[model samples]
Target: MDWITHDEDVWFDFRGSSPEQLTPGRFYKGTVDGFADFGVFVDLAPGVTGLLHRSELDRRLESLDWESGDTVFVQVKNVRSNGNIDLGWSIRQSESEFRGAHVHDPDGDEDGERIEADDGGPEPVRKTPKGISTESRATNGTESGDELSADATAEQKRVEAEHDETRESEAETVEPAETVSAEPDVVEATTSDESAGVEQSAESHEAEGTPERAAAEDADEGTEAEETAERTEGPAAEPERVTVESLGDRTGDRVRIEGEVVGARQTGGPTIFEVRDETAVVDCAAFVEAGVRAYPEIGEGDVVRLDGEVELRRGELQIETEELTELVDEAADAVEQRLVDALSAKARPETVEPLADHDAVAAVTEQITDAAEAIRAAVLQSRPIVVRHAATADGYVAGAAIERAVLPLIRDEHSRADAEYHFFTRRPLDDPVYGMDAATNDVTRMLQDNERHDEKLPLVVLVGVGGTTDSLDGLGLLGVYDASRVVVDADAVDTEVVEEASVLVSPSLTDTGAADLSTGALGANLAAAVNADVTDDLSHLPAVSYWEDTPEAYRDIAGGVGYDERRTRELREAIALEAYYQSYQDKRELITDLLFEDGGGLAGHVSQQFRKKLDDEVATAKANVEARTVDDVDVAVLDADSYSHRFDFPPTSLLADTLSRRDDSAVTVVYATDELFVRTDADIDVRAVAGAASEAVPEGGVTAVGVRQNRIEFLSGARETVVDAVVDAVVAQI
Candidate 1:
């Protein structure tokens, strides 16, 4: 038996665990998805996939109609991690077939698909009865095929099928109800037609692929469960077998933990990385005994299922590995993970290595980590993580914890979720999905540092409390935004999808002179302040309207730095364009990849959706201004993702001062990002100019022309008309 150490143990001192001798194939046992049809996918061990084909689903199932969601019962087959093994097994087969014989009649070898080839070829496929096959034999060779006991297998499969049919006929007397609530409920008792009709009101369960038999079983005349048993299995002296059920809620002997992966932590010793699944992170030590690298690879966002004893390790409840594996068979999850992974790589290519393309949760964790840090710093400094909230005064907000503590005076979470701000964090990060110690700590630090000095730091925390859930603390960081941040805490709300962590500024500076707010300086400021450089002439910003437009009006409201509307619009457009490109590019890639699955060459469904969306964008570019810009740049309506920026330094300047990042004396930014930018007087057109752009292009098939009201459209083939209409509308606005 594999024994897991308690939390207090040194072994538990590690953030994760190493593979032990006991936690392998036989160690993992799970109830097969009893209702599974076609195939049953299982994890015989961590990061392993085993498939039980429909042919082995049941003796009766092969010839019957099977639907997609039908679940079944399964267990680990022989496991050789280094070598692949057919991972599925079944019961309910003929005795001969179960003994490793072909289920097809030798005389009927008309197709030879089920035959042991005369020449060296695959062994005739055989079925099993005990739901387990302990033998190991080559699946190929004529020598292998000549050694056969399978004539019985073929006869048995046919017998099992016929017997099942007979039993099903008798079972009609029994009332049809929900597909077996569980495998265990199919009892040995027989039910007859009278009792079923009189009491239970037997409803017909249309078994898949089953045809109506003209003569009903005579045994079904009376109501009895044993009668149904006879109907299903024929005249069996043995009782019907009971299968284990999946009681969704675990009040029994086990606990089911489920969640997304957010972050990874490492102890001082091990080289293995932690696999942070959402339910809770677990210790996955690499395996070295098999002469293979243990902890070979582990990345964030891997979906996992673990059945282990709930042990308290260092005050944390973690499972001590009875069973665990990455869930990779589901198509939707796999696709989502691939997109997020690609995005994360593009966003932060340096700090982390690429995790598997299938771990979506892991990539999102990385994103949360990045976004949270930016917001944390902005809030810690005097910058507000601004956004457009309908009823708030500031028009932006902070983490929930900050909001609750500061809202008594500030009164809003405005548009924080969508604003530009810097975020900061402590090293070796730790917290729940929303993060820990720091969500509130940054604000606390600001207050304390200010209090110790009493003149500079004014603690103004902003939060979003209206979006509360059962798991949320009234004023925690998670309450402000649902987007998860990278942290280890399970109690906090930061690991979900609706909110994010950020800091809100009340814009309290009353200075009537000086440049006021430093553009793109909040993150560096906090970093500097924490490092004891608080006197950097960092001007505080004045409040401005969420919908305010134009540099002059912005300046009038700000009173110090002129509102950089051109810059902000430019930035906004860039951000939109970048986001749009990401969306569409991923669509193109996914579609392109679909042509490869099982030799498919067709575009994927996502690609179809993206193309359709682009076609629509071409048709309605002008009126739908926000949707028109990829972020801000308008390109050929059909290929907005292919649009390149033309504004040069122009669009780069339309951002809020708080959004740009400062190194020392200079601020730097990518033009097509951030929906707002700082407009330094520049000659470049903020949007694309068709006359100039077309002339600039070397003679091409179709040239992209101009920008209108921040919308960019292009000239092309059939796509040109749509682009023309959209660009024409926007150009009229400009």
Candidate 2:
């Protein structure tokens, strides 16, 4: 094998130019010279034979349809000394798909496929491959259910491996399986003698991966995606090859084209239809209107070689072909084209819907949440469900209780948080909530006098409720209180509440009794769900769980969140996020209500307990509100308006967008769930006018009203109930 110091700027040791130097990404059509369980080897020219995997042999379809002498188009992948080459194939019977198939040459943009990203894109064209991308199916596998699914799960990602911009670095750092490049650095295998004294290949796995395990991990959602990292190969590997030469109307040079056959004449017309490259696809009319030339029989997955000038016919990439060849390299190429056609034929690219790409964390969170939701749904649907929530006791914290109540419905073990207090207390509760009362005047007074705020302002939010110690019921109010305190603490903490802190109002049994967490909250049925849109802030926070009960539990993880059942932990996190969302949204509304309204912020107020406060500090507040009809509402509302929030962060917004805010100042959603009851020392019949929502919010939906604020409270119910109520509330008149 000697280097060819010939006219070509290519280098070769012996078995032809490398995969990098192959033209049109294909060597040429060859015949099967050998067959093995692994694949069928095809002889291209003389010294080269390409491989067609056994996997490519259609089991359900007719094998007789394909013969040894069958002329196929193929692109050369790896060139083995023994003349073994990897052949790409497709069983698609479509003429166009057959004509356009090519190998994995990076020179031009004959890419693999597009993925279902979370970021919404315009609807796609091909509708065949459900949950599959047009781009990927177009260039990879066949779009049958079994094959498509398998492809999604096992196909190797071949793009330039680089995290997309959507990969938010500031997000929780996840150990990436393959972060360096698309093609993992090759490692040579070493042989070792085992028990039988037989030689075995030992592939010392790298620090972050094992192909099997990694593959499984990626397949969790059927598809793993990386941005299209350009790696040019094939004839177009060099930009010079992509150029087309218009040689005196006959033989052209440097022309690269991709397309499907619309019409192939056994003798006359040039293949009709189109040829697509990187930027755009072009419609090319064949030049052989001459004597019946082999009908230019271009089948699907066959790469049409355009040896003539590239004429842009009405904005289309129309190439006149002097030669026609099949892209018979890796069988994957043909499969991909057929898959694309099937997908496109199944539907149009415009119809394929774009999906939102979930980040690792978001994905994990979504899975967990979806599992929880599934459990909740099954229980409520299949079986009789009475979602439980408590006034004070019963058995559960906002996150943990819901997790327990619905655990039975879930077949997967990952839905549970694994531990109660530890995980739930991450953003724990604190401070005994003390409010004036939800009266119009008090809310108004509180809103106007933004400063001199006391623990007894119209609303006082308790953060994280502590974890359960003894019986679940005993952990109710106190637990809610503890958890509440934990949630409100402005600073991050790392301790779990060992006392009866993780309690909450059981959504299950309206019965206000201690809880029984050990039973997993079954039997008595459960209650409703908390809102995910709320933004209530937390206070007196406790520490979160740092370590799990077992060490080996998390052996499979790279960054264990202190447990082996990482999936379970993920589910817990998702629930917590939803709860947090509800609480946050609730808080935002409370603030908006307290600070606005034409009737004057807090247009109504009649809290007996707060009345005492009014009597106690009425003078100080009146003095504050007296100024400017006083823009107390404007002042208080404006003070905190500088911040932006998100249940869904805006894509265009900066990453630093705040989830919670206080500015060391005005209003905040410090804990809205009844996990911790915000109480007023004084009890009284408080009738407060909370805008027009007063009607929409049924007396029952308003679980616990603020002892002081005009319209602050907790609202929870069955998923459907809450979803409907929320939708209605949001769609309410401006």
Q: Estimate, for each residue in 1-734, the C-alpha lDDT of model 1 and write its tens digit.
A: 53342211111001111222122222122222111222333332223334444444433332322232232224334434333223344342222221121221223333112223123222232343211111212234443333323642454345446434532111112221122111122222233322111101111111111111101222222324445666887842221221111111211233333223322333211112233321113332221111122222433555543333333322222333223344456632743464345334432324322111212223233432454344333332223332111111111111211222222212221123322222211211111111234345444554564455332332222222111131134235434433222211111122332333233211111122112221112221222222222222111111222223222423343334332443333222322232233221212223212311212213233334434443443333222223233334332221222332333211222221222221111211112221212111123343434334344432322222111112223333334343433344333333
Give candidates' CA RMSD values in order.
Answer: 25.6, 28.3
Q: Which sections of candidate 2 miss by over 4 Å? A: 1-397, 400-679, 684-734
Worst 10 residues of 1 by lDDT: 197-206
Model 1 scores a C-alpha lDDT of: 0.27
Indicate the worst ten consecutive residues by lDDT in candidate 2. Answer: 535-544
What shift in Å separates residue 257 of candidate 1 from its native position after superposition?
Answer: 6.0
- Candidate 2 structure quality by residue, lDDT tens digits, 128-167: 3112233334424443434444454343221101112221
What TM-score does candidate 2 get on C-alpha atoms?
0.19
In candidate 1, position 311 carries an lDDT of 30
Residue 480 error, candidate 1, Å: 15
